[model samples]
Target: MATVVPPDLELFLTGWLRSNITDVDGLQVGHRTPDGYDGSYPLIVVRDDGGAQSADRVVFDRSVGVNVCGWTRNSPKDCRDLAARVYGLLTGEPDILVGFAEGSSVCAVVPDGCNGPYPVTEDAPYCRYYMTVEYSAAGIRQS
Candidate 1:
């Protein structure tokens, strides 16, 4: 008997990572899990804002490998403060264009990461939690 087969999970995950990390520069997501839930974890980077395990509370670990560094949420006045920190590493005043789902009203920097006078929303989804997952499990146990 032949059972229904779902689409390639790896491909889907890969695509998801790429789409999510669009805000980061020169950053690309990858997967190397043998078997697990989706099998992926964006890169790790120092962060101050976070929410959920993934779509919620998140924090930075200052340790990760090649992956998508999560987003930041510093200062209530604007969300770009965190992004500004991330992009700041690249540009003195980064005016990044973070596009959601490849290209969807690509958000712009507020006034920290970029040289924007007054923008709205962060470029990418709040990735503080997503970035926390990206780590080097090569030395850790699976179970």
Candidate 2:
């Protein structure tokens, strides 16, 4: 029987977020904002600040930051509402991503979901909210 190779934590995470968050219609989600992303209101960009490896190297902990930014031409409330949705989606369940790979998904003990809407940058163009989730990836092979 061919053994099913397990996916790395980082890879699994990227895929998980893409599948979970980007599925929302009209929301542009990616690891990086799309080129010429200007005018693209309701954009979500995800970044992973890779975590420290466990002593056994079978686990890791990292912070996944999602920035929900948009052109709030008329209403900042729209942006706030979108940010709330984003927060709820991310904080729903850390276990949702645990089965991504066959016996390879990260088993999260505690997912510290979401951090900031850190001072919205209204720089004449777009309004942005920065939020971060801290999650631990257990049973993930470093290799």
Cα-based lDDT for every prediction: 0.30, 0.61
Query: Any runs in candidate 2 off by more than 4 Å, and if so which?
Result: 1-25, 93-104, 109-113, 122-124, 139-143
Q: Candidate 1 deviates by what RMSD?
A: 16.3
User: Model 1, 1-143: lDDT tens per residue?
Assistant: 43222222234335544554476444444454123322122342322221112222122111211122333333222233433443443222233322223322212222322232123344443333222212111111122
- Residue-by-residue lDDT tens digits, candidate 2, 34-115: 7666645677777777666667665666677777778654556666767776666555545553444454355653445557
- TM-score of model 1 relative to the true fold? 0.24
- Clash count in backbone of candidate 2: 0
User: Which pairs clash inside model 2?
Assistant: none
Taking all chains together, the TM-score of candidate 2 against the true structure is 0.69
Residue 116 of model 2 has an lDDT of 65
Candidate topping TM-score = 2
